[model samples]
Target: AHGVARPAAPLSTFLVGFAAARNGGTAADIEQACATATGLALEWAKTHPTETR
Candidate 1:
């Protein structure tokens, strides 16, 4: 999502919400998912930033 259009932000949020709805959609689960995603994104950015979407 690094160089994508602004619309992608809401799309990503929707996807995450959809995924949460499929699961428990609880606060703890959401926090865990966000933390995991943040860690992975940070790692990817460090190693392969230019490959970002």
Candidate 2:
């Protein structure tokens, strides 16, 4: 398995996406990451921006 655990892969991917969004990465990258994490399309996230703390 090349020393990689399949179960952990999704977590890693989710982190990358969250980091990208938090860091204000390009709209496309942020959207893709959010979509992957929520299973909802990027368009949905766009309509529901997170409130700033």
Candidate 3:
């Protein structure tokens, strides 16, 4: 979300936690959620790239 919006960082983290909690809040759940979020973010960054300024 670098080229997107400043609020996306916190919002994305909140969403990852929310997803983990909804799935049971176990270690595995948290890991899965983080991995999923990170993977998506990476893919998005690939297409979006970082902001110039």
Candidate 4:
């Protein structure tokens, strides 16, 4: 997991949820998107720390 700041983590998840909704995301879509985003976050954290929380 990216080291997202505790205070901002849930708020940021809303953005991700909105994105999933905008894309007509079903449960599968949400899962896939979340996985992708999480993977990217972990990768970015290795260098630039993309998480706010």
Candidate 5:
């Protein structure tokens, strides 16, 4: 982990956006998918607290 950098947004968000675009979804649809992924991440964090470094 010394040289690795985490993405600003999760990989899931990117994947969802890419899939939506490839499937002919509108820009707004992609945006909605990304937003949904972000909300899901936050909910996951709420359920599983991380330890301080």
Candidate 6:
């Protein structure tokens, strides 16, 4: 969230944990959730480079 929604960083983390739990609370599930969220964030940052707040 460096150049994006900094305030949303914590919310994003919570969502990732929730998703991982729903998918089966395992290390692999957590890893997958983090990867998926990271990919989406990167894509969003790339496409919406000027987004703020």
Best by TM-score: 6
Clashes of 3: 0
Name the 10 consecutive residues with the lowest summed lDDT in model 3. 1-10
TM-score of each model, in listed order: 0.57, 0.43, 0.79, 0.67, 0.59, 0.88
| Candidate 6, 1-53: lDDT as tens digits | 68666799889999999999999989999999999999998898788777444
Q: Which tens-of-lDDT digit does each residue in 9-44 have in candidate 5? A: 466656887877876799887877778766776787
Off by over 4 Å in 2: 27-53
Task: Please give me the total number of clashing residue pairs in predicted model 2.
Answer: 0
Q: Highest lDDT among the candidates is held by which one?
A: 6
Over 1-53, each residue of candidate 4 has an lDDT whose tens digit, in order, gives 22755777787688779878887879977887788778877776789745444
**Clashing residue pairs found in predicted model 5:** none
lDDT of 2 by residue, 2-53 (tens): 2344685678676967778777788887876766655543455477665556
Model 6 lowest lDDT segment of ten: 44-53
Q: Over all chains combined, what TM-score does candidate 5 have?
A: 0.59
Model 1 per-residue lDDT at 8: 61
Q: Sort the predicted structures by TM-score, highest score first.
A: 6, 3, 4, 5, 1, 2
After TM-score superposition, the amount by which residue 51's alpha carbon in candidate 6 deviates from its true location, in angstroms, is: 5.7
lDDT (tens digit, per residue) of candidate 3 on 1-53: 55557788899889999999999999999999999998987888789767675
Model 4, runs deviating above 4 Å: 49-53
Badly placed stretches (over 4 Å) of model 1 are: 1-8, 50-53
